[model samples]
Target chain A: MAIIEVNGISKSFGSTQAVRNVSFDVSRGRIFGLLGPNGAGKTTAIRIINHIIIPDSGSVTINGIEAGPLTQRMIGYMPEERGLYKKMKVGEQLIYLARLKGMDYEDAKKATKYWLDRFEAAGWYNKTVGELSKGMSQKVQFIATIAHDPDIYIFDEPFSGLDPINSEMLKEIVLELKDRDKTILFSTHRMEQVEQMCDDICLFNNGRAVLKGDLREIKRSFGKNTINLEFQGNAGFLDELENVRINNRSTNFAEIRVLNGESMQGILKTAMEHTEIYKFERIEPSLTEIFISTVGEDNINPKELG
Target chain B: MNLRQILLVAKREYLTKVRTKAFILATVLIPLGMIAFIGVGVAFAVWESDSEHRIGIVDETGRIFPRLQSVNEQRYVDVSAASPDSLRQMVVGEHIDGYVTLGEKNISSNANPEFVYGGSGGLGLQTSIRSDLREAIREERLQRAGVSEEVKNIYDSQIGLDTRKLTAEGEETEDDTGFLTIIGVVMGVIIFISLFGYGGLLTRSVIEEKTNRIIEVIASSVKPVELLLGKMAGVGALGITQLAIWILAFMGLSAAAAPVAGLLMQDQLADASRLSDQTDEAVSNFDPAVLEIPSIDPLLIVYFVIFFILGYLIYSSLFAAIGAAVDSETDTQQFMAPIMVPIMIAYFIMLRAMESPDGSIAVIGSLIPFFSPIVMITRIAISEVPFWQIGTSLVLMTATFAGTIWLSAKIYSVGILSYGKSAGFRELLKWIRER
Candidate 1:
């Protein structure tokens, strides 16, 4: 079921068109990702869905209800530029936000306690946000977003400022939310995070969704001609490869995309000669390649496409 | 339109502010400051009056000197035995405040006596000495002219005018316009402080939220109008709380001191009754109530609160919008002038209203919404304000407040989310016009 259906919504700030003719659907019990580079209208689209910024045209519906304050209450939104009142105590701030989302005082307090304890931040309840470390406040903000237990959750760049440990913790919680059949939507340019989490995605380029669909199907549709090579040697031989394009290359790993009519086995053979291959496999193009190819292609030929 | 959300937001705003040190300081300090100001003035006056001056009279004409009595806290002593040089030395040595030499010409109409002194005496001391000398010279001249003491007493006596105010109902009451003006001035100052102090606080709070980037999170949960109103309600409630504390303190102080004031009134009345017994029995029929301080009309206080709330709502809404338009407190400077101009103008008009509450300017200003809160409250306190004018002013104020909130909410809704760009006048206008 389409829990959120955005129909060709457009928004502008002054003369800058922040979002243009953007349309997408987020399904129930699924993790949706809005993948785009900075200033590519991903944040703007998320805000529009949250009804923080009304679209200049078209409409958005959540569970058949038009996107507004009513629909807003059903969603837990952690904005890209998220923060808590620096002088407010962690517990009170969370409860305040929960109450604003329609929770009564008792319920808000209970939920706040549960979430703070879950994040292992029960001691931070009495501490002001200003006194908390950056990671600590980020966790508080996360708790504030979900304390009301909204059915649909929207997180914009939720992993941006987090350290690796907290990032993993956030991922685990998000996956746990998904396991409970909550519709989750998050926007990020970090492809690995999207790859590990999102079941569906809409790739945005210059305020337009250039590609969108089920993650597995989208990856499959790109074909399995790419070679994922992991080795232990200087990657200097990657520059000599013909009939292939190196999507990414590092000391021990390179994802080389095989051009049409090129064999992946031939590329693997070439790589094995220069370096010892611990692991090499033929696979479909990563989301990062598809993102770069789609958004990068649009960037290269701006006038023709824009 | 969610009442619960607005209440929740307002509750948070109120609690956060009320718990702050600044709020507690302001609430307690302002009344203490006013009391200190009045206490200082009274103490200075009492000290001035209590100061004593000692004078040495170098009288060449002994007849004129002996007739002079000690007056105006100045004491006279004979210094004729001392030489002119010694008298000067005495003054320099601080033996006396000053030495005044009276010659035979001092008794004449164009008398100019020489007074030698250190620079310690003020103009008040000199004026007192001159008046005392003139009185003695006049008495000497009158004695030489053979004028009787009875005639002199008649010549010195003066009459006083009794002031009364005739009401619209043709009843005369003791005039207390002076007291009323004091009330107006005090209330005007209170309103001024509350408007700017609380209004600025609201603006800074908005800027804080924007700077901290918490506004977007809150914005997603509530409508901008609701947020703005909740803040206004919260801050407004806080302001009222402070005002209530001050008013209660004043009332309590007055209640505690009323008996003492009444006792002082009775003392004055006793003096008047004694005078009346020596004069005519009809003079004793004077009403003692006329001498009593006029009590404040509770209705005026009610009007004050109403006007204050209306005024605060109107100004704070604009303050909130200004807060939203700018990213920081420093960026608010460009917008402050426009908002401040009206308040300043109203304050000036209120000053004029105190002098002549029924003047054409006062009447007009009191009816204009921007000026009415301060000006009309002053006018109402000073004299009888027509019910229609008060009714019209209240209506206009409410309507203006409603319109201001609507326009301000529009600017606020768009401005809070916008970042990086410091909003100019043109940008704010665009935001107000944006859908």
Candidate 2:
């Protein structure tokens, strides 16, 4: 069953329509990725689901109830632009947020302690947020997001400021939550993480959902015409290829996409002539390529997608 | 609509703010500082009045020397013999406080007698010396004209007008308009300090939450109105706590000060009471109660609290709205001016109208809803005001309060979510017009 469902929701701020006829769903125990460039209605759609902003039209339902204060209690949301009181201590802030999420003081205290220790930050409980390092505060922010034990969780760009180790830690925790059968939805501009983490995705662009489906099916629908190449030679032949685009490029490797009616062998022939090919294989297109081909170059945010 | 959530928010706000070091320091220090200031002033006055002076005389005209001896201030000053040239040396050697030199010339000439003093004399000392010289001159002229001392003494007494005020009901008392003006000033100052202190706190608190972005998380769980109200209630309760502490401290200081005052000012107290007793006898129906700067009327205290709460609510809501509209404290200046002008107008009008509390300007000013919160309380303090006027003022203000909160909540709902450039009035108006 769909744990949450959104149907034809539209929202506008003044004359700017932030979300237009956006619809998607997250099923039980599945991870839903909301993929978009910046200002592509992803945050707006998430805010509508959290009931922070009222939609101009249509509806959102969480566990069969309409989106509102009740649904808000059942969902833990960490916004893309995260903020916590700089002067407030880690312990007080966590407990305050927990209490707002409907936990009693005693329960909030207990949960705060449990999460602080789990995050290996029990010693930081009394320290003011301002005193913490950026990553440490992000740790506190993530704890605040999940300490209340909500049935569903929504995180917008949760890994933006995190280091690789902490990002990996967040990924593990998110997967752990899925193991406990909690529905999760997150928005991000990072395509690799979405491929690794999301069971389903709703790709947004220009305030509309341009593509969406189960990750496996979406990738399967785009036939195999891309090459993941790792070679130990000059990449000069990359300029000679026709009807293909090179991405994720490095001196030793590149992700090459073959356009329609263009054979992967033809690109391999050009690449072999210029250098030694250590490894080359015809493979299904990555979500990044699918995203690029579907949304188009003009739609991708250079700041985020580049 | 969740009262539990609202109260939780209120409790958190109150505890965090009141626990700050600045709050504790301000609450205890301001009142103690005021009392000490008043104490220093009283001590200076007493010390000045008690010190005696020893003055030397160098009257070149022997005709005036003997007449100066019988001067009334001779009891307070020891008038001694001295040479005209040595007068400065006398004062410099500490043998005399000062000396008056009357050169051998006409009394009405360029060489009018000069009185020079040594030591740091108070500002009023010169006026005393000048008046004393003029009095002696008058006495000398009167005696030369052969006028009786008894007649001259009677003519010297300056009798002021005995004025009183009468109500329409024929009840009359001594005019105390000056007393009323003092009350109005005190009341205005209290209102101004309170609204600025507490209302500014509310604004800063809102902006802090907005800037912190915690407001978004909090708002998801509670309505914007609840958040706004929760903050106002919390800060207001904290203000009341601080006010209560100050009042208790003031009462304790006043109680302790009375005995110390009696010990330090025993002579002055006795003289003041004797004068009051004499004045009591002179008036036909004099009551001892009128002598009292009436103890703070409990009714006046009640009025003060009501007006303070109402005034704070109005301004605090307006400030909170501004806080939501702007991203920073500096940006609030544009919106802040509009609200401040009305408060300033109310205060100035309160001060100006205090000259005639029952005048048409005061009466109308107290009835205008925005001004009523400050002006009406002032009018009540001065003289007997009608029940109908207070009722009318409260009704008008209560309606305005409701309207202000409603409008402010609308703006707050939209403004808190809006980040970046400071909003224009048109944007705020659009927010207000939105559902």
Best by TM-score: 1
lDDT of 2: 0.83
Worst ten in a row by lDDT for model 2 chain B: B279-288
Write the residue-wise lDDT of candidate 2 on B177-217 in tens digits.
67766776677667877777888898899999888888878
Across A1-306, the per-residue lDDT of candidate 1 in tens digits comes to 799999999998888998999899999999999987777899999999999998999899999999998998999999878788999999898989999998888999999999888888899989999999988888888898898999999999998888887889889889999999999999997776669788999998878998999999998888887888899887898898887778677778889887767866777777788888899888888887787676664483323221
- Candidate 1 backbone collisions, by pair: none
RMSD from true fold, candidate 2: 6.4
The C-alpha stretches of model 1 lying farther than 4 A from their native spots are: A122-127, A231-234, A240-244, A260-279, A298-306, B41-160, B260-293
Chain B TM for prediction 1: 0.72
Question: When superposed on Cα atoms, how far off is each prediction in RMSD?
Answer: 5.7, 6.4
Deviation in Å, model 1, residue B189 alpha carbon:
1.2
